[model samples]
Each structure stands twice: as C-alpha cells, then as structure tokens.
Target: MTTHLRPTDLRYLRLVRASAWYDLVVTAGFATPWTYALLHDALSALGRAWGLGTLPPLDPIQTLYANLMGSVVVVWAVLRLARPLPLHGLLDGTARALFTGWQAYALTQGAPRFLWLFLAVEATFAVLQLAPWYSPFRRPAVRE
Candidate 1:
C-alpha cells in the first residue's frame, strides 16, 4: 500500500503515536500489581480526604482481565505506530469514542473526580484520530 500522506496526516500520525505512548504508561500503571495497589490506595486516600467514596479493590479475575487488555492495547499501539494505516486510525478512534463515552457516563454515576482527567485525554486523542478521517480534503485510501 502506498500512503500519500499530506501534512495533516503526518500531524495526525504524530498525535496517535504520542497517545499510544501515553496509553502504554497509563495501562502499565493499572496492569502492574504493585503500581496498581499504590494507585488504588492513593486514590482511596484522596477520596476519603475529599469525602467521596473510596475506590473498591479489584478482584483477582478483574486484575487478570485488566492486564490482558493492557497487553493487547500495547501490542495494537505498537503496530499502529509502526504502520500508520488509515484503518488503524479509524478503529482506534471509534474504540476511543465508545470507551470515552462509557467512562464519562460512569463518572456521572459516582466515579472519582480524577477519572475526568483521563477522559479528557482520551477525548483529545479520539479527536486527533478522527479529524483527518472527516476532513474534506483527505486523500483516498488505496489498498494493495
């Protein structure tokens, strides 16, 4: 496949790459056992201080599932960053939109205030991945 990337496409790709890196770090924090506990404890303390309800501890099964998902996201991000395909941006953007929407809704249902910060990051990355797709002047996709 030959990608005739315009300047905007290059910019979008860069944004995606950065977002991938950010996700890698954030996901790692969740997937790692020690860091996960630390983060949970910290948030719980903060919530208690702020008079919000404390975060619940994750069960073993939930931890396993979260780690598996984190591993998959890492692999997908690496592959997409290495190739920068239009489909990558499309799929990632769509997934991010759904995930962000779900997260925002969950936040409304009594999640921690800090979750909003993560939501903002996800929404920004989703826009970066989607804007080029909806641009009037985008080059057509050509599959070989």
Candidate 2:
C-alpha cells in the first residue's frame, strides 16, 4: 500500500527520528555502568550543592534493570520514528510525561532536588514530542 503524508507529518517524523539519536545517547549513558557512575557523581554533587546531603547508593541490580528499560525505550522510539507515521510521537511523549510526572511527585516527597533538573529536561522534550499532535495548524489526519 502507498501512503501520502502531509508536509507537517513528514517534518514531525524527521524531527522525532532525529531525536532518537539524542535519546540513544542519553539512554546509553544511563545504561552503561561506567557512564552511569559519572551521572551519579554529578547528581551527588548537585544534591550536596543544594544542601540535600550525600545521595544514597544505587542498587546495582535495580540500576542495571532501569538502564535496560531505557535501552528498550530507545530502540522502540527509533523504530517508531523511522516512518512517516502521524501518531508515533504519542507513545514516546506519553512515556516521558508519565515518567516525569512520577519523578516530580517523588521529588516533592523527598527525592533529591537535583532530580528536578532531569525532570525539567524530560518535560521539555515530552512537550516538544507531543506538541505536533495538539497543534492548531496541524494538517488533516493521515489516512491509513
């Protein structure tokens, strides 16, 4: 079957696909043991600077699992973004939004203040990913 995508849809696909590279970099950083330590150290310093005291140690198994999950997300996003599909952004955006919301709640309840920075970044990207769907100027829906 042939598909005729609007210009905006094509633009969105390109944007999201390009973003997958950034996600891969970030996911790998968090997934790799050595790189994760760097992130942990930076987060510890941020916490100390914010007067939150030393950060707790990460459980190795949990961290590894979390990294694996992130890696999976990266792969999923890459696959979804590879095509000029209109709704693919929904999955990535929703995932980020939900995760960010949970982290925001946790931060308020006692997660390190430093996590706020990460949450901010996540929220920003989530908005960007989801915005096209909600845009007033978006072209008519793609017919499958």
Candidate 3:
C-alpha cells in the first residue's frame, strides 16, 4: 500500500526541520554561554538577596549539568533533522509545554523584569515551533 503525503504532514516536516536548526544554533551558540552567565548571576543575586551567603564557586557539577542539558538539546535537534516527520509533533509539544511552564514560573517568581528576557525567547521559540508550518504534521485533532 502507498501512503499519500498531506499538506499538514508537509508543514509539519518543515517545522521540524526549522526547529532542529534553531535548536542546534541556540544550544551551541546562544544558550551555552547565556545560560551559564544567567545562572551564575541569578544564583548569586538570590543568595545575596536572601542573605544565604554567596553561592559556592562554580564547580564541576554545574558544568556537567549545563553540558548535559546542552548536549541533550543538540542530540534531539539532530534526531529531529534526521526524522523530521515523526518528531515534529513531539518537538512542538515539548517546546510548548516547556515555554508555558517557564512563563508560569516567571510570573510566580514576581521578577517580571528579569524574566522578560527568558519569556521573550521562549515565546518566540513556541510560536516558531507551533506555527502553521507544523500544523500539517500534528495529529488530526490539533491540525487546522
């Protein structure tokens, strides 16, 4: 039996490909240093603000976690690029959930100013991942 390609499927593939490229760039180029710096400052500030003493000097554990997370993102992106069709919905859904959670956390933290940068990045990623380009790749219920 032959399977026919639907417009939605095509769109989904496009989304997956785009998202894969984005992830690769962000993980390797943007997020690595950016997260390290942000985490360092945020943790230091939180420690100082609460008088909990200064954060311990950055250590191997911190580096390991950052590297692991970054590697995971890179691997996932590579997989999406290799198998765009099957991974499209999953990637988009994951991005949406992650961003939504981040938004909620930012709101609850009551540090809107600091969180805005993260919120903006997450929002942009969410929009790009869930755009009509990927709608075709979604399951029937989610497709428009």
Candidate 4:
C-alpha cells in the first residue's frame, strides 16, 4: 500500500482522530470501578428520563469487565489521537464494526432501547472509516 498520503487521506485521518477522541472522552470515565458506578447510575437515570428502562445494578463482575474495556479503548484512543494514520482508521473502523455487532446482539437479548443510540454512532463511524472511497488502491498511484 501507498504511504504517500494525500489530502483526502488527511481528511480521513481527521475522522479517525475525531472518533478516537470521542471514544476517549466517553469511555475514560468507565476505566475505574467508582467511575463505572457513576456512569451506570447516570445512564440509568437518563434511561428513566427518556422513558427507557433503567440499566441493571452494577455488580463486581460487570464493573471489572467495564473497567477492562474502558481502559483498553482509552489506551487505543490515545494512540490514534497522538499518531493517527489511515491504517488506524481502517483498524478502528473494524473494531467499531465488532462493537456495533455486539451491541446489536445485546439489544436482541433484551439489553435496552437506549443502546440503539450507541449502535447508531458506532455503525456510522464504522461505515465512514471503512468507506471504499478512502481505499488507497482507488487513488492514483504516486510516481516515485
């Protein structure tokens, strides 16, 4: 693949960084047990306010998994924020696809209606990052 980045590549890089920033901001708060508790409660309250069912009470295992996911995603987000590249966008989009899939699966399992919001965002980003227009192969080859 071509490493000769183009203007369009720069635009895609921005999208990658932007998505990473979003993930960092949103998931950072879940990296700890205490923060996860707060987030859970806040989400639960928001669900009620919106007429959606409340989330289940936070348990130790749930907290542990949440913290793990948050920590990993936060670290990955920081990587893209600091050194974003087209490849990063492709990989992040791949991860977002997986996330969207799992989120949809959860909903099908009767998780919550509020989850649709997250799924929408995930799927949108995934589509944008993975869009065929950004494929390096489609760009005019750079003459060395």
Worst 10 residues of 1 by lDDT: 1-10
Which regions of candidate 2 deviate over 4 angstroms?
Answer: 1-8, 49-54, 80-84, 135-144
lDDT (tens digit, per residue) of candidate 1 on 1-144:
544344346666676677778877777656666667776787779888877667768677766666676778878778876876667777888889998998899888988777777799888888777766764646765599
Could you tell which candidate, 1 or 4, scores higher by lDDT?
A: 4
lDDT of each: 0.74, 0.70, 0.62, 0.87
The runs of at least 3 residues in candidate 4 whose Cα sits more than 4 Å from the true structure, single-residue gaps closed, are: 1-8, 133-137, 142-144
lDDT of 2 by residue, 37-129 (tens): 777777788789888755578779857866786768667766865663556666777788998999889887888777777688778768777
The best candidate in terms of TM-score: 4
Error of 1 at 77 (Å): 2.1
Error of 2 at 137 (Å): 4.9
Q: If scored against the real structure, what TM-score would every candidate get? A: 0.75, 0.69, 0.53, 0.88
The alpha-carbon RMSD values of the candidates against the true structure, listed in the order shown, are 5.0, 5.5, 8.2, 3.8
Q: After superposition, how far is residue 73 of candidate 4 from its true place, in Å?
A: 0.5
Clashing pairs in 2: none
Stretches of candidate 1 exceeding 4 Å from the true structure: 1-8, 46-53, 135-144
Candidate 3, residues 1-144: lDDT per residue as tens digits?
324334356755776677678778766532365666566667568756865444456676766666776777788778878877644655665676686686678567653344454567666656655544354543354356
* Best model number under lDDT: 4
Clashes of each: 0, 0, 1, 0
Model 2's alpha-carbon lDDT is 0.70
